[model samples]
Target: MRRVGREEPRAGRAVLPLSLTLVSGILDAVSFLGLGHVFVANMTGNVVVLGMALGGSPDFSTPGCLVALAGFVAGTVVSGRLAGAVPRPPVPALVVESVLLVAATAVAFAGLTPGRRFAAIGLLGLAMGLRTASIRLAGVSDITTTVITSTLAALGARSALAGGDGAGWGRRLGAVLLLLAGAGGGAWLILRWGPGVALVAATGIQAATGGAYAYLSRRRP
Candidate 1:
């Protein structure tokens, strides 16, 4: 476990990445169900939808998928440049993620109606991309927050039932459950209130995650 702020890594102290994962699930759900038939955080789904669009599926849009993929990649590029600029514990990265998520929430509500849905998708995708890239450099294990394919694989491989040591199962299980809970909550919010409320909720959680990290870093040092 890599230290985020010079403190010794403790067991069960995975609130930060779990929160980010929850945000990802929420944003992805909002984007898919509310904004458009597209995924902002889950690029794999976008790729599949893009393929469907190319195959003449009327339900998907090539332009929307392209925008999201481009935005996500661009965010990764931006974060790559900032990776060297930030100090230890990835505080700068968290700041950047928080700001991006807030901006995404604002953009989603800034008249991004059905006509301008692609713009909102791009913004949210960019934020997720930035977050994924920055966190990659953080050296955290079993908390990618963006995708769980690897996490699922790890869980299966490390499970005692699979003839291996049951290490890292807790993180993997927590991530899976958090993502599920987030997606369910986002869907409920979208059905009851609107996408705006879901985005606002995600932004609040992201802000809290960053704030908590900042406080912990300060107290540890």
Candidate 2:
């Protein structure tokens, strides 16, 4: 299946980006499975779900989908603003992501009852969307946590008949695998540990990543 993650930054390790990818996956899984049948990261799926809901699809929650769509937009906007304002590189980007994720985690944990889908979905979507956007703005290229259409497409083409430099395949594969792991883990957590598990895990990972960045920046700065 064409090994991935070839686009490695000159920095230390790919742990941070890979963690962020998992964050995206977990958020996607929770949003789709536990909170509501919507995707916080994959806006395309969110739109499709929204359309189906509007069309009176069975068991589709219109309110939930609309809420997620709106939250994701808000998150993206917030992330963009943060990236523009914050200094480039170092821990700034991760700082913003960590803050947003922590906030979302609070929301999720506070309302993690069997029926608190609104808070769960809304909070997670807001945080995840913002984190993904932050990754984009930070120039963490080819590590989009949400969707993988272009990445997969490129991987398929480049690793195929074209026979070009496959430097980024490792990173690409890392992103995909991290996401799948997140989704699978999220689904399992939701089914076993409940909705709170997903948000807790996501937030915790982001916070750790942020801390690592901060430490690294200070050491090098």
Which one wins on TM-score? 1
lDDT of 2 by residue, 140-217 (tens): 566676787777887777774678777778888877888889999989998998666777888788788778755654
Task: List TM-scores for all candidates, in order.
Answer: 0.90, 0.83
Worst 10 residues of 2 by lDDT: 1-10
**Clashes in predicted model 2:** 15
Give the whole-model CA lDDT for all candidates, comma-separated: 0.79, 0.71
How many steric overlaps are in each model, in order? 1, 15
Error of 1 at 184 (Å): 0.8
lDDT for each residue of candidate 1 in 1-221, tens digit (9 for 90 to 100):
33332432342146777888899889988988887788888898899999999999999888888988998998888777776655543566677777876776777677667556877887887888887876776564457898888889989988998999988788889899989888999999999988889999998998888777766655543
Among these predictions, the greatest lDDT belongs to: 1
